[model samples]
Target: MFSTRKMWLIFLLYLFPYANTAQDIIFGQNKFTEYQIGNMSLIITVPHGGSKQPSTIPSRDCGCWDMSSSKCFFTHNCPPGTIKDSINCKVSTVKDLYTLETALNLGKEIQKITGGYHPHIIINHLSRSKLDVNREKDEATFGVPEAEQAWDEFMQFINTAKSYSPKGLLIDVHGHAHPENWIELGYLISKQNLDSGAFTAADSSILFLSKESYNIPFETLLRGDRSLGNNIQEQNKKYLCVPSPTHPGPSGGNYFKGGYIVKTHGSKDNGQVDAVQIELPRWIRDSSERPIFCAALAKAISNFYNFHFK
Candidate 1:
């Protein structure tokens, strides 16, 4: 019997003879999503930087739709200009500004670093008000047929990319406007758990990495000398990442542990693929800083992958 990894490879070889072929595939209305095929064993997904907003599909609201009342009520406010006929509840409509550009450039930097090995990039171009591909289906599309179609196309593309690499990393790129200017490298460990030291390998998005008997402690892999945070910091001191040696934990500040992307795509027990949610601050993602930071990030990613997966 073939090993699971081998079996997966065989399956992919059968299903996609051109899985390694590099090309751009666009989906959804007005081509709101795209998948850039590449040769590297890496995939980058940008779910929140979508810009298209087709009025044919209503914006997703708080998701607490009231059938009888014909209204949706939730703690958050709906997108701007939403009327009563619309689900007028709060949903995060703010785009992750510049994340798409950052992802695309990061792919190029990775290609340069790897001598033309491109990282597969999946980009969602729909506005967050229309669809939040990171969230579950119901919350993402609010039953809008058009939005739902886009979500399916976006997610299927990620799965397809994963199929090409039995072992790889999925970097879910995002941006944050938090008070702190440091980067947030989320492995699905919450701030509370990180602060209290109450989390374990089971709680990690990169559980596959934790399961490896690398003779290295899990804590070290998380925030010690061997962590991605440390690697990125080593590449550039200006870009500090949380859960690194310098910032071991949130310390009771604003932070995002991770979101649906990492939690869903990250490997489980003994799984080959691992994922990390990278939330960058405006400083790092801004046009002036992006190219330099992408270089640093590509180096860090190459180093981390070599150290762990190679």
Candidate 2:
């Protein structure tokens, strides 16, 4: 009963797949990173924590930040005599010290502490020196085929993970060498903005997550008891967090506002997934002290989920 034109259109539609919908997608087999499905609506990504640098991929000409600098890229606050990149690729590309170990360990700790609430964990095993998984195409892969493929694979995995937690949280983990012994929680707003209380949920880096007003002031969600920072603080692990119960912002110090991973895959601008970038200091991310931080992070995540998302 269909017209000839309609039938032809239907045939063409079947012949050409216009887009890949989130529903029918699969994961992990071809991904450049390791991925696992979990019982909880959560995701954690260790982007710049890999130690491998396959010579097949060239060293990124996009210079990185000093491993010892106290300043941050949010305000282009690189110190004198340091590399000032207009590309704004100033955040430390050097792997976040022991982040992979900590993240993996954190996962173990999470299972033990939370009575078995598994969360999807994604770790980019390729070194940043080879491919910056957290950056966009032009800057991320530099148009290299392998890098591009890896980038696509990583993103696909992230999107796939998001499908599992459409209304939950995403935590982008990284390392920082700031002078302070605290975790720098980035909600996309800068240290200056948080200090002045001059930002909106829409202004946050987690666009999609912030779109749905959580029935609480945006600032409160950034640091209150229901906030990720608060739970981490309450754990008494000694690694205090910025914009948390004790500290509102970095004050006179530096902080990473967020990054490509947090902004792109996160519910920035519009989605049910809220994402936060947790930049851990050496005191917490170092191999020796990682266990303490991992335990604290697991508890923080469990507490945050119970109080807010659950």
Candidate 3:
């Protein structure tokens, strides 16, 4: 005698033969992307840390060409006085160093904190030079069929994870090489907005959080003692995070202000699940401090969950 929920799950599985249940991680075609479905209401995506660069999928062009040059250079290193051609794509081929490893370790740490509750993890295994999943379809894959299919698969996995965690957090992880050795938490608000304090809840990725029953002030949620940045900073005062209680904002410095993944999936557009783009510093992702940072991040995320979601 199956419970109603179990019966419904079984019926749906029967109807959709290719549907995935709560089990081991699954890979997309050609192993371009992989996903781990989790019981916990959290999702993490690593878009720029992929390493696979097969010939089947052509590299995404930078779209900067020298039309006036005799050689007609397609690269950015065009000679002096060469007339620059169209520059269409937001081209960056360099991979976010060690972000995939950081994300994997972060998931493990989170599971340990939650007493074995898994967090949905999605990783794009393809190299950013081959496919930039962070960009839009045309620019990301450059109209390559294989890359297109992989992109669809990656997006579908996120959608599937969203179904499991209907009202949770989606974290887009990446590593940055900014001069300042501090973490950057992007909420879809620009540096100018943060400096001027002119941003509204509607401009935030976690828009739904401001409207929750707790009645938390928007500014407090962004950089107060209970915010995610503050939690991470509390773990170790040395581990500075911009937009925290101490930092407040970037203070007219460089900041990511979130990206396409957060913009497309965050609560601002639809659904209750808020999205956050976390740009980790190079030291946190590349040095001996990786595990330490991962632990702190896991604890901070858990604290955030307990404070807000619980």
Candidate 4:
């Protein structure tokens, strides 16, 4: 019997046929500016959903890794379905895409629920394969120069939104590859030794999904005897947080488990702009488990918004 999640995923796969291919798959340096700005209270960014490759870069040009068949054993030889699988595996074919769609849809839902007050979304047109918004330009493999320009645009968007409303919020949307298969929220903190005002400086605030900044119940749940290391291993058993095996930090799991997007944009010191990063496991929305994931995501977002924005 198909699991409820898998059943829902099949239904959506048919609903969105365009998600299955790689041709003309636009990726990096692309920004989606479709939503209206002044009408909302939040900004949503998806930095890793891009899949487009640079025109200058060849199809098989694996950056840094030698493609020459002589030097590398697997040069120019990717396994069949590797690229396609990677795209489908990482990109939000349904829920990721649906999250933004639903926010837009929420414009109507809000009008119905509270008589007004909707949120605005700012998403990247590019895929994670192009430029990872979460990672610094130096860390990206393609369009390093263009990615910098995109990053500037992202920051500018945040500044502009704050200027429009001193009470607005910014959210960086993302997914994680882990074994636990649960939702994770991350906040930015000022990394030790870094200037507080600069974008490079990390913000060290804990993101609370519940209304209160620090919910005792939630904190206790997160602090369950399981160390971070144990959490990662356990998470991977049922979900996909990272592509491969990696060691987490001493605190328990990988110290750098959260991406750069969460580390950079989540700042509370800059009045009126609060940010949080959400990480969803792939199993939740895979071809076999999308329905269950979508419902869970919708509920999570609703809970998160109500806790903070309501």
Candidate 5:
């Protein structure tokens, strides 16, 4: 006799109490594939840190994989490394150069900073050459059953985190090898769009948190003095970032400007959760230098969340 909406509410409240209480969930068949699902408002995803190649799943066949080929779907050029693998490849798609290490490093430090409190950390541990979790389902999974299951689990993990907290931040961490060593933050607005002065809240990735949840102006939180960029700057002034509220977009060459994953999972939807895609450079990902960088970045995120997201 209950209405559909009421019934759904009851389902979420009592029938799915485990969904609300479970703090972590791990899904994978092997080391090459895995997803770490956490129960925090802050969601972090590293789509390309995997290195387990079974050769069971066929590597993706995309023109971008060919460096000499003229077919490139992504705005930013493919990064260096992962080229030695003989998978009939030219451009790199095997991995994102220490991205998984960076995510795990950041996650560990954040957990320490939060005093055992955990964040929703979702990682794709399969080699991109085997399965590109960041690409569209068709291109990402290539119709493979196993890879398709991974794709589903990744999105489901994000949705699960969103369900935990009505308002939170989701950051997709990636590695970039541009000539400049600056971090590229993607909020979905393109270089041309930002220059035209026509960019609006609807175009942003974190506009939901900026406008609706926090009741703060989108521009101010994006690049303002109280933004995530500022938090990172506080951690290390030597580090430089772009596309913040102040920078808007990259100055030259092709930039990431965000990707399929960020758009699909970010606050572009009507959800209260906001998201940002941070593209890290090798300088920060270096073994010796990574520890310090991760520590600082983790602290910055903690401070930012306490100030704005919490």
Candidate 6:
């Protein structure tokens, strides 16, 4: 007969491997997987969903970029006497990873529930400190030369989605840090002034979730209102051809300064590539409120896909 301690040890050895595997799936340390079954094509692009900062990049301002320097440095145009460490610069946070993981989980849920209308996701392997997806090639802070390479990756993802054709949509996921805590949604149209009379018109329409639309629920929630839950309705106010919160004057409550990704890829006229940018407030996925916020966002996106795709 076996001793009690020996039997217990044997049981644990078998159990440990299974437990670790389950944790890995939930935590998403493994490589991202894509699923496809139904004809509908929905591509989810997460530009800022990164946590690993490149070892090659420096966190503090060193100097301006020049040909001679072996390691490239970019100027921030900071005011004089600013301490390198004291300067408030955008840095990568674990929050971004959590948000992306939540999005992946939601995507999986959508795939299973929708019977294989799988949503493809593209996430940046490097942190925003290295590159920002919302900026133009010229405006990139660090990887200015790599802009073409990044664009190539984006195009490749688009091409893969296009294989399905006709019934396709692109979702650009992001997070925002705004005082009012809003989520913005809309598309960027071509401004006539920017064109040098070269291209006939802007070739694309990028759909974005704006800060104004998103801020309402977050502001309300911060004020301790939880009655509506995730069933919050869009306030039917208008500003600059987009929906805004019902407040007067040029600076309407719901109007967010839309970013580059929205401006670049959004076009309704060009064979139905709908680009929607979603900006979730920092507090939504902050350490304290992540579980509830994740559920709420998952439900929101699920509802959006079901309604639009069907």
Better of 4 and 5 by TM-score: 5
Taking the tens digit of each residue's C-alpha lDDT, what string does model 3 give over 78-105? 4565544445324778999999999999
Query: What's the lDDT for all of these models?
Result: 0.81, 0.70, 0.82, 0.42, 0.71, 0.43
After superposing all C-alphas onto the true structure, candidate 4 shows an RMSD in angstroms of: 14.0
Quote the positional error of residue 261 for candidate 3 in Å. Answer: 0.4
Off-target runs (Cα >4 Å) in candidate 4 are 1-38, 57-117, 141-144, 188-203, 206-257, 287-300
Of the candidates numbered 1 and 2, which has the greater TM-score value? 1
Going through the candidates in the order shown, the clash numbers are 5, 9, 0, 38, 2, 23
Model 3's lDDT to the true fold? 0.82
Error of 4 at 133 (Å): 1.3
- Put down candidate 4 lDDT per residue, 30-147, tens digits, no spaces: 3322223434555666565545556542232342222233222112344433332232223222224333443334344443444455445555554444545565553343344565
Tens digits of lDDT, candidate 5, 103-147: 888988998999976777777877887677777776676577777
Using lDDT as the measure, the top candidate is 3
The TM-score ranking, best first, is: 3, 1, 5, 2, 6, 4
Candidate 5 wrong stretches, greater than 4 Å: 1-25, 37-39, 63-94, 213-215, 245-248
The residue-by-residue lDDT of candidate 1 on 1-310, one tens digit each, is: 9855445445544643334323443344457777777666788999998788888977665645455666654322444433433334456778999999999899899888888888888888999989899887777887777888888878877887887767888999999998988899998888999989998878888878877736888899999998999999999888888999999998998788888888888885445778899999998888999999999999999899878876
- Rank order (by lDDT, best first): 3, 1, 5, 2, 6, 4
Q: 5 or 6, which is superior by TM-score?
A: 5
Q: Estimate each model's TM-score.
A: 0.85, 0.79, 0.87, 0.51, 0.79, 0.54
Q: What is the lDDT of candidate 6?
A: 0.43
Worst 10 residues of 6 by lDDT: 234-243
Query: Ten residues in a row with the worst lDDT in model 1?
Result: 74-83
Instruction: State the lDDT of candidate 2 residue by residue for 1-310, as single tens digits.
Output: 9854344334433533331223222233233456555567788888888777777766665443454663323222335555646354543357678888887898789889878777778777777866778776656765667777777767866776676544888888888888776788888888888888788778775554334545766667777665778888888847688888688878868888888887776666667788899998887776788887788788888888776677
